[model samples]
Target: MVSQEKKIKVVLAQFPLETHNRGIITVAGMLRDAGMEVVLMGNARAEQIIKVAVQEFADVVGISSYCGGELALGDELLTMAEREGIRDHTVFILGGIFPPKDAPKLKEIGFSATFPPSATREEITSSIKSAIAARSLG
Candidate 1:
């Protein structure tokens, strides 16, 4: 039987190195409320994907890029996960100011979902829940 506490490991990747950590924190709180274990990342880092995953024991990673480097950043995260043999276990999500043209490309690169800045909190919450459910089913 599943435990009453549903823990969802999450990583929030915001960009450039400065700005309010509000979005990350907000989503983290919501996930936690939904019984998830959330791990958040700030700014950009080549090594942070693996590092954060290892540190968080993440089931999923939420990468946000307000900066212009989201596509490359998201791919790097997925590549790191694949190399570490963690891909099968981690669901990847990209959020923030993504260029529409690059959206499908990011998905092609392995992001399970993409959310622009306007995406609602409820949408994100539902997405997380759906990912968790899908992971369990698969």
Candidate 2:
């Protein structure tokens, strides 16, 4: 694990779809275990995610979407973040079932990182740490 002088705060947005919660919860556990502060926002809209991120002073907003509408939702999240003026300060991440081919599009929409459902716990945790560190550097 990377040596962190300050704990990174991450807010994981729950997908509106019911079946997707399992992996999101698992990732939340992994993130919390990795020495970061994690808040799992249950069934939240993009607006709520942005609001909560600001309120929590979160460094990253992580979403695990497995319902196949990630592209649209991810775009919406970015738009909301931009509108709320947190687009630069907050790192947005997506994991779970997003097609690999669409990662570039997601990045273009301001996603800091994107992970497939095949990502291991180590990968998810490491990506969050890396994104937070990168954002801090810039």
Best by TM-score: 2
* TM-scores of all candidate predictions against the true structure: 0.81, 0.90
lDDT of 1 at 118: 76
Candidate 2's displacement at residue 131, Å, is: 1.6
Q: Candidate 1, clashing residue pairs?
A: 6-35, 8-36, 8-37
Which ten contiguous residues of candidate 2 have the minimum total lDDT? 14-23
lDDT of 1 by residue, 20-130 (tens): 566667667777776766666676574666777767788788876665767776677778888888887778887777579898998899887888877877888788778
Clashes by residue pair, model 2: none
| Candidate 1 Cα deviation (angstroms), residue 29 | 3.3
Candidate 2 ranges with C-alpha deviation above 4 Å? 1-4
Q: Tens-digit lDDT track for model 2 on 1-138?
A: 567588888898865664758788888888888788889887888888899988888889998887688888888888988888888888899888867898999998888788887788788788877777787789
- True-vs-predicted CA distance for residue 136, candidate 2, Å: 1.9
